[model samples]
Target: MTRALVIVDIQNDYFPGGAFPLVEPEAAAANAAEVLGAFRAAGEPVVHIQHVSADPEATFMRRGSHGDEIHELVAPAAGEIVLQKAHPNSFLGTHLESTLRDLGADEVVVLGMMSSMCVDATVRAASDLGFDVTVVHDACAAPDLEFGGTSIPGGAVHAAFMAALSDSYATVVPAARLAQTH
Candidate 1:
């Protein structure tokens, strides 16, 4: 069971002082850093995914912008792979799947910003692609969402999405678990 860590869109835009900041981004990023450290210490594969929008009118993560850069918390080290993606699903129009395969990974460990979007999409796609998936719940963040005139708090949104993903998509666990096992 070879394993790889996929850091999905932990970019500056999701952090404080950037576009589209999410709730508890620093806390989630700290957790993600810990998991990333574990993977590095164990000599496992790590792939950093950056969301770069090509649309000129996009409010955030515009290509070549600072917001599109991956946060320093889990920045790709020299020799590590960094994949730029235009969509929430990391595998779409990206070399993520092929890269993982090339790295001999059969299982994927994912953690990053916006639990309700990229994290959700990437987890589902990984599952569909037949890779065993594990999501670090505490290592992911989410922004508050509104639906039908109801405002959903970011915490609630994150929990709801994690719950949904845990039910069928992946085995969701806290960052500490991976740290211990790593």
Candidate 2:
């Protein structure tokens, strides 16, 4: 079975000094880049998913904004697929499903920013689409969340989401472990 890598929303807006910053984004990006290199070296298909918000009041990822641009860390190189999406679920209204199918990929390794949002959404969607999904836990990050006036730390949020997705949605592993195999 063919395998592909789907990088979701590793944009400037999630990094420091951008619209909405996440915790340890640089570290996450670095690990994600390592995974990208692994896929490239193996000559596997890669899909870079860029999210652009249609919401006018959106704080980040607005069209034509530098913050909305995919960051240089794992920027797309020639021949790598780059797709723009408008939703947290990368496959929604995008060519993601067809692209993976066209590449004959039965498995997809995912890693990206905002672990609780895009990463979680895309992993579940990919699984529902009948693809084997593996998410690099260390290559993902999450933001602090608030609920019922209670604030959750980013690290805790990241851990919680990763835990939630580990067995049900995808087999979650750290970038280091993936590096050894790739």
Candidate 3:
């Protein structure tokens, strides 16, 4: 079965010095680049998913803005599939499902920004769409949050999301293992 790596929402705004940056964005980008390199070296397919915020009030990823573009560290190669999405779920309101179907992919390994949001959304959507989804835990991150006067660490949210996706929604895996897979 053909396998594809879905790098979702590694956009400029999610990185440092952007409108809204996630925790450890640079490291996530670097890990994703490593994974992408491994996939390319093995002649595997990669789909770069971008999230464009339809609302200008959105802190980051506003459509038609530079922040919505994919990060420079991991630029899309010529002929690489680029799916633009308006929602947190890449498969919703986008051609992502059709693209994967066209590519004849059976498995999808997901890695990218906003671990608790977009990453989680994509994983669930992929699973519901019947693809064998494996989410790269270390290659995903989310912004810190505050609840009831307490600050929630990004790492905690990231871990929680990974845990949630592990058994039912999708298989949670590390980038190293993903690199070893087809």
Candidate 4:
């Protein structure tokens, strides 16, 4: 099966000293970089999805800002595709679906920042679009969230989202498993 690696929103804003930092962001980026290397070595298609917020009131990921750029460790190569998006779903308001289609990608290996939001949205959307998806759990990160005065740790939030997606929206695996697959 033809497969593509979709690296979503591994931007500066999610890292340390950026606008919005996620839990274990550096470690997650390293994991993603490792997976990216595997895909590159295997001659697979790799697409980088960048989130550029259009809202003027957005605190992070403001368009044209330094934090809006993808992190250097996992930045796209010259021939690789870089897609800018304004929504949680990468396929929405972007050429992600068409690009995948053109690359003959029936399966996608996904990883990146904000697991509870972008990763969750993209995996479900990919499933709805009829593409098989494999989400690298360790390669994704999320920040702690608060709801009704209760604080949810980032790790818990990440695990919950991965668990929800597993066996339903996508097969959630680790970076090592991804290497094995390649």
Candidate 5:
């Protein structure tokens, strides 16, 4: 089975000094970069999914903004595919599915910023789309979120989402395990 690495939303906005920074963004980006290097070395296909907000009210990642660009740590090399997506699910309203099909990818390794959002959505969607999905737990990050009257810690949120995803949507693993697979 062919495997593809799908790096989702490793954008400047998720890092320090940018709007909507994520928890441990640097560490997550570093892990993602490691996975990217493994995939590149193995001659596997890599797809970088960039989230560009179309809503004017969006605080970060607005189209044409520097924050919307892919972060330097895990930036796509030439000949790599960079897909722009507006929705949290990368395949929605994007060419991601077609691109994956064209690349003959039957399994996909997913990682990136905002584990509770983009990563969560994309993994579930990828499963529904019939792709065997694997999420790199340490390669994704999420910021603290406030709900009702309580604040949920970012690490807790990330762990909960990853756990939930592993229950049905995708297989959750570490970057090291992914490298072993390749």
Candidate 6:
């Protein structure tokens, strides 16, 4: 079975001090870069999913903004596949399914921004679309949440999401483990 790497929304807007900063965005970007490198080395397909917010007031990532561009630290290679998406789920109204099909990909390694949202959405969507999904926990981030008048730590949210996701949508694994799998 062919496998592809789906990098979702590693854009400038999601980085620290950017439009919509996430927890440890820098680290996520670094791990994602390593994942990309591994995929390249293995001659596997790499798909870069760029999310552009159609909503103007949506923190950052407005259409045509620099924030919508791929983060400098995790830039894609010349021939890497790029899919521009308007929604959190990469498959929503996008050519993601067809693109993956054309590449003959039966499995996908997913990594990117906003662990509790886009990352999760993509994983679920991929699973629904019949792809074996592997989500790299260390290569994803989420904003801190607030519950019962207390701010939930980013790490807690990240871990909780990973635990939940492992049950159904995807197999949650550390970046190192996923990298070594190739």
Stretches of model 3 off by over 4 angstroms after superposition: none
User: Tens digit of lDDT per residue, candidate 6, span 64-173?
Assistant: 88889999767888998899998889999899999999999999999998888899899999999999999999999998999899999888998898888899888888
Off by over 4 Å in 6: none
Superior candidate under TM-score, 2 versus 3: 2
* Candidate 2 lDDT over residue span 74-119, tens digit each: 9999989999998889999999999999999999999998899999
Off by over 4 Å in 5: none
lDDT of 4: 0.95
Q: Give stretches of model 2 more than 4 Å off.
A: none
List where candidate 4 sits over 4 angstroms from the true fold.
Answer: none
Task: Using lDDT, give the best candidate's number.
Answer: 1
- TM of each candidate vs. truth: 0.99, 0.97, 0.94, 0.98, 0.97, 0.95
**What is candidate 3's TM-score against the reference?**
0.94
Q: Candidate 5 on 100-175: residue-level lDDT in tens? A: 9999999999999789989999999999999999999999999999999999999999999999999998989998
Error of 5 at 60 (Å): 0.5
Where does candidate 1 stray beyond 4 Å?
none
Weakest lDDT window of 10 consecutive positions for candidate 6: 14-23
Per-residue C-alpha lDDT of model 4 across residues 53-167, encoded as one tens digit per residue: 9888999999989999999989899899999999999999999999999999999999998999999999999999999999999999999999999999999999999999995
lDDT tens per residue, model 1, 3-113: 999999999999889999999999999999999999999999999999999999999999999999989989899999999998889999999999999999999999997
| Model 5 residue 115 distance off true place after TM-score fit, in angstroms | 0.9
Relative to the true structure, candidate 6 has a C-alpha RMSD (angstroms) of 1.2
Candidate 3, residues 42-131, lDDT tens digits: the string is 988899998887886887788888899999878999989888888889988988888888889988989998898889888998998899
| Candidate 2 local Cα displacement, residue 134, angstroms | 0.2
Clashing pairs in 2: none
lDDT of 5: 0.93
